[model samples]
Target: MTMIAVCALWGMLFSVLLAEPVQAADLIRALMFQEAQRVLITSGRGLVRQFPDGAEQVMTTPVVVTQLDGGMTLNGARAASDMVKVRGRDDDLIITVAETPVSDQPQDRLSDKVSDAAGSAVPPAELGPPPMGALRGPAPLHTLVLAGAVQVIRRGKSLMVINEVDLEEYVKGVVPSEMSSGWHLEALKAQAVAARTYALYQRMMNAGRDYDVVAGVQDQVYRGRRGVDERVQQAVEATRGVVLMHQNAPVFAAFSSTAAGPTEDAINVWSKDLPYLKGVECPFDANSPYYRWRAELSLQDLENNLRRQGIAVGTIASVTPFSFSRAGRVGRLRILHSEGELILRGTDFRRVVGYTAVRSTQFEVQSVGRTIVLAGRGSGHAVGLCQWGAKELAELGYSFAVILTYYFPGTEFNNTRFGAQAPSSTP
Candidate 1:
């Protein structure tokens, strides 16, 4: 059979599998690094290195892994194999990858190489560090102190770092990174369930892929044990294995920082038109720092960014909102350039301009001179749950279950066999 046939077969199989309940003991494979040039791996307690041939060795010192012409070099020694696994010895399996510099290749070239190696077209931006969130921007050094086994796989001339962690532990790491740990406990609990469900959903969908989710804004921001604290632990434990279920399968459980006005429909953003992901009245997050914002974008820079992304365009003349979604956000935009008229999706425009610059599609073009001025509200795609709205609900004495149901209407809690059992119903 051809590749498409195989993918179709797997999709059918996973659709059947989705009906089955997920287990709390399930392991989550998260991608940490894509096309990294080099990485230093070590364990706080000693290191147990497992070779591809099933042989294991214990090393007390740090191991520098670099992509070699054939495979990889471990501490300057040639390892003919394409993969290696590292784990902590006699400890909680905390593996640390220190000072790993990302690939110096240009974004498009790196993405092409990865897509060729992985047998799929991966987005250029995803092959690098996250564009937004706590890990956004360039850093001189990147360190990941992760819990669980770490796999270093050589693909082409680069390496991909993957973390295999327990489901609950992964959720624990996500809770604080996606939302502030200082928020109310109820809000934290809601976030935990959402994060867990999203991970599980992605895992189920991408069972044939190398990893389930990316540890960044692409999925959920997961910093391993970095932001995990007492409150975060309590929240994860309280809602352990609880996920929002629609028709026996876990919903996508998408959430964003703020839903400045009303929560958005997933169809409008991701084209996934699930009943539970419909827009709803959400005026509770007005106090969000991103609830209101202004941005100025030079048309020249916009044209340059678009061309860099392989979009053919000429000098821009004007940009106007062509259509709006049900939530009153721009759905499509008309870009009048010197060459011709180019219409782009509002979401795609945000990606081209930069997520931080154009926070959301819910903005109006104030002016279109040499530069574009935008006044908008909210941050993120505005689908499913609103983090700020959850915070306000929790502060108003609402239970986590209530908060979830309010945002994701028609979804109920289903507990996988892990962590503490949730309450019988929303209080």
Candidate 2:
């Protein structure tokens, strides 16, 4: 390939890998060949369509979704003879099985709001259990054919589904989903711990909801069995039940593919003053493609993007960096529109303009003609662990514990099981 073509491919892969967290939701099936071992997960979510595949042979079957509470209320059990497809309609949900529709709308039609073991909303830094509790999964030691037994449920007008798999199996899928399997074993082990911690954290945050985490980057990408890698599986197994703990609770454990330089404190990114999420020098990820990169967008596209996100910044005349974080990432940006000047946080601007376009907060902004250029370093929200840095350290013989400690200070490994939480403690 030509130099330009090779460069383009490199950039594309960098962007895809650095896409970081993808909080997506979907499904294909859920077949149970063994007895369930009480691991429950909300199987699907949001404007989703499900059909019988494999041996079902175009046949439709009624789905049974029951609340695990005493008397085990069957939340959604279709009539034995109907196959239903759920749809989100304006502020309500609709289940369509046959030609006619069964309006199984709750009288309240309220959204699924939840809290933790305590009745209060868990702090952003901590995970809270769902009000409805967790759903049991199929057979403890068996691999679930998630494509079967797939069903849909309603949370107001939002329809959601989830894959109910064993907690350990779910962690296995996360190992490869969050990071490449080819990295050093120590780095992969660190990722496993982070993934497991975050998975359970999401579960708590989404308690009483249909599913804990999505299948995309939003919560940490998970591919079920398909995404699992043998090396990644070993990493997950090695670190089984091992979690990073701070004051007896799982830390937020935010991570990025690369930290161009020193990691940034979580407070700078999310306003969460986490003790362990403090920024530290990381000269290890210099090898990341995103360690240095550039992107440019025409003035017209910039203004159009703002409008698309409902930001009325009339015609864009100029864009300026309003502020910078301690990590050198843009903390705030000023937009000079024809109507007036507006200020927006760097993070929000990244979301509106396109995350991959901005890449990282550490960047220089310049303009040439009618186009704006952002030459930046690093990728992802600069907080918590740095994946590339971990890999580099591991290459130099650093174990997972050492790698995790280097990124997240004041944290210690705590061996525990699923859904476990300890009392809060200060480092």
- TM-scores for the candidates: 0.82, 0.65
Cα lDDT of model 1 by residue, 192-298, tens digit? 88888898889878979989988765576677787788998999988766777876667798887777888888888877889999998887887777789899999
Local distance difference test values of all predictions, in order: 0.75, 0.57
Candidate 1: 10-residue stretch with minimal lDDT: 107-116
lDDT assessment of candidate 2: 0.57
TM for candidate 2 is 0.65
